[model samples]
Target chain A: MSLLDIQDLTIEAKQGQGRQAIVDRVSFAVPEQNIVALVGGSGSGKTTTGLAVMRLLSPGLNIVSGRIYFEGNDVVAMPEGELRRYRGKQMAMVFQEPLYAFNPVFRVGCQIEEVLQFHTDLTKGQRQQRVDALLRQVEIKDPGRVARSYPYQLSGGLRQRAMLAQAIAANPKLVIADEPTSNLDVTVQARILTLFKKLRDDLKLTVLIITHDLGLVRSLADQVVVLSSGRVVEEGPAGEVLQHPRHVYTQQLLEAAK
Target chain B: MSKDKHFVPSPGGLRNFRKNPWAVCCLIILGVFYAGAFLADFVSPYSYQNEDRSYSYCPPMEIQFLDEEGRLARPFVYGVTISFDEFHKRNYIIDKAEKYPLKFWMKGDTYQFLGLIPSSRHLFGVDAPGRLMIWGADARGRDLFSRIVYGGRVSLSIGLLGVAISFTIGLLVGGIAGYYGGRIDDVLMRICEMFMMIPGFYLLLALRAMVPADFNSVQVYFSIVVILSFIGWASLARIIRGMCLSIREREFVLAAKVMGLSDFRIIVRHILPHTLSYSIIAIMLSIPGYILAESALSLIGLGIQDPYASWGNLLSEAMGIIQINFSPWILLPGFFIFLAVMCFNVIGDALRDCLDPHFQVDENI
Candidate 1:
């Protein structure tokens, strides 16, 4: 089985007295140990599609029809209790806004440790050691000090790094990162993308990165799926599609990135 | 990093709390009152309900150091001589011819200290029974000062207890309503509105009127607390629900949910902390309402019945034109009521100011 697969996924939002399809019957898959970028512009259902893989769409939004299979189990049909266990342990997510992602009261290390505590039976000392190691893996200079710090205390680059650390703390097989580097400047964005690449290669983590930045897609993605207004215009291997674009929209997207 | 410049770390954890002068003053006053209340049995000269008929309507004893022979003596008080006013109310005259010396740490009343320790050597007492009444005597000859001290134990404690119960309900109900937000919200918020629709005092009176009047004062006090909590929690729940409505949608809460934390855990650990800054302020501000509620119930003879001195029941003596004209000291309890409410209001406001997240963190703060 593919590590993560989507088949005929259709999601809808409730408009006035009607249901409007946001993500139409589009299908894609992330093979084991590869990076897949869902590339699209504003209002293209990129983020919504990413959330559907985890079955975490907002309350009003509905998955009209779909099957999201992580490993052999259908994520769409899994019960809440089982889905909970499946999320933090088997598949984790990092969002675009790291500052808002963290609980403000707790220290960065404490938040990271909470995940380990819930998902694993690790002792306090073991969890602490894991948190320190993960922070360091994300290229934090001093994990000890940074762990004790709050999200507001860290700069934007460091905050994203902390978020990445949290996302991979459970050693998840897959990480669905939604617009992970959209908020950072060019230099910091490049560094974060590099960090993602290293972690993916080192841990063989299947990454489904959602972004509108095609420049990032060019360098990082193995397979690029182009979405426009909730429909996939082009889906192919990154080099083939990047060099010889098949769709007009893809051409415009690539042209705009330059 | 350059981020450090803008972040300007707080010097110490409680720096904001300690730096506010009004908060510290309120803290000290509340501490002193609560401490005095805790030690009421030890510090008070008489039991709360102990009445000496001979000292009825007696003026407060004047503390003097002189004996009859022009010699310095121990602290003593002149005996009271009773007379009649035009209104037929008994008037008291301090007769210097007879003096009763004050004794310190002397055995007076036999009662439970803090309802735990069994001993009663009061802080100070008159050498003879019925010789002194520091805040004068009420119509029933009970010492006003002693009753006020003892009343503080009941009034202050009931306010705190009621708040504890109310806040527990508010946090859970508000949290669930806001976190879940559908039929549950509708049901809960409507129930909350039902509570809000009733006038708090009438609800208090109605609920309290149902309890058997034969129960002892302790039971009555507890019933009052429960009723006050029932009335107080609705508005608090509504406020907390509104706060939670906005907070539940925060990215952090969604992040916690996405991480597969059980809903209860997310509400308790992840969501509640965001509402804490508001909850704490709400708690402080609401305490005075509880205190006032208890006092109002007692003032109407519906709460902490006679001889179980709460500030409200104590001031209930001044309810009539006759009592006010004859004995002004019956209103003495009102001063304590004002002081307690003012302390909570001031401290609550100060806490809100200091705890405001919008307040720019500076070196002084």
Candidate 2:
């Protein structure tokens, strides 16, 4: 059985005049310990699809019709309380802008510890120790130092790592990273990709990496689902999809990648 | 490993605060005022409402003593001797020292300290008739100094209480409006605007007039606080609502929501904390305005009345030309009013620099 299954999902956002559907009949499944890359251009609804899976869509955006099954539980049908229990612990997400992802007022350690404290029965010391270890796992050189530092004190790469550390702190079954490395330098991007690969292998973590970069999909994703204008243009094994492209949009995306 | 293991102290906000001297100075001034207000009984030398007819119009005392040679000493007035001038005008002098030594906690008139502790410690000696007017006499020869102290108890406390009431209501209303933007936001904002449209001073006056004239000083004081708070909250609410509107969209707030944190928790923990630094700065800044408002209302005789030593009431005595010409010290309350307002503003700015994230880190740092 798939760890996460989305069947015939549709999401609509209320824009100026009428309800414009952002994600139309999008469907995919990720088995346990697999990395799936949802790839598309800006405004292609790839990110929207990820948000729908997590049920973290903005206020105006409505999940018009969708059935999301995660670990044999229908997410759309679950009560808010049950969904809350699964949100940070069962499924976690890393936002695009790491700088804004963490609260600037609080130390990075406290932000990570909040997740652990909320979901687990850990004491203050235990939570702090766990946060420190997670920071270290994310290749933060001085975990204690980074833990103590505010978000503004850290570099973009460091902030992204801290965010990743926060996401994985609760030992989530599925991790959704939305444009995780889009804001970083190319070199930092490579290192982050390597770190994500390492984390996935070590923890047997299922990851849904949403990005516009097909190169990232090629490098890290086991499977790829290409979205265009709220519709799935192409979906297949990452290597096969990239090598033998069926859709014109996929070819254009590949050309853009080149 | 060594690089990772090395100690790196998290820089403190104080280091940032030091970079702005103006803020530090303001903070110090505010600290002084707060100390003065809190320790009014300790700092004040006389009862706020005490009267001394003999010490009327006495020039501030200049300490004098006998020389070693036992000569009449270098022309030092001993104690104040109030008398009529050749023009039959009231005059005073330091009657050469007759053992009117400064005293502490000497039993005189009674006062309820903080509405709880009952004590009789004037911190300075009373007059011959047990009246201790440190700042000399008012129109009726009441202690101006005592009134100022006791007046502060009303003037200063009104700002805080008013702010407290306004802040609570404003935060709730504004927070709701900002968080849920749309028709609901529009409706709330329009209501806020409606409140804003009413002439604030006139509204305050209307509210003040509604309170029964026979209300006691405490009731009157409380009513004024409520009135000021009612008028005051709209501005703060508007501010908080605007803040909430922006902060609600912040990534941390979105992150909190994605973490499955409750709406209330997200609003309180994530969204509210962001606005607090600004709100605190606003509150501090707004206090002087509140105090000044209360003072003005009291001075106009619509606020604190006679037997109350509010700076406003003290200044009310300075309204007539004769009092203004005869005793310029009546204007002394105005001086305190200005000082208090300036002190609060400076302190508020300083706190903004200290607490504001934008102001905390200097360019050089």
DockQ values, each candidate: 0.47, 0.31
Best by TM-score: 1
Candidate 1 per-residue C-alpha lDDT over B111-183 given as tens digits, one digit per residue, 9 for 90 to 100:
8976888997999988664456888878788888899999999899998999999999988899889888899
Give me the candidate number with maximum lDDT.
Answer: 1
Clashes of 2: 6
lDDT by residue (B1-365, candidate 2, tens digit) is 12221112223544665767776776676576666677676567666655565666554454334543675554332456677878988777544445354455666667666658987666666445333444567766666766676677788788889999988888878888888789978998888888899998898889898999899998999999999988888877888889899998888887876776777667677777778878888998999878998998988999898877677877888899987787777788898889888877876777776666665455575
Two-chain DockQ for model 2: 0.31
Clashing pairs in 2: B48-B146, B78-B95, B78-B96, B78-B97, B79-B95, B127-B131
For model 2, residues A210-251, the per-residue Cα lDDT tens digits are 999988999899999999999999999999999999999999
CAPRI level of candidate 2: acceptable
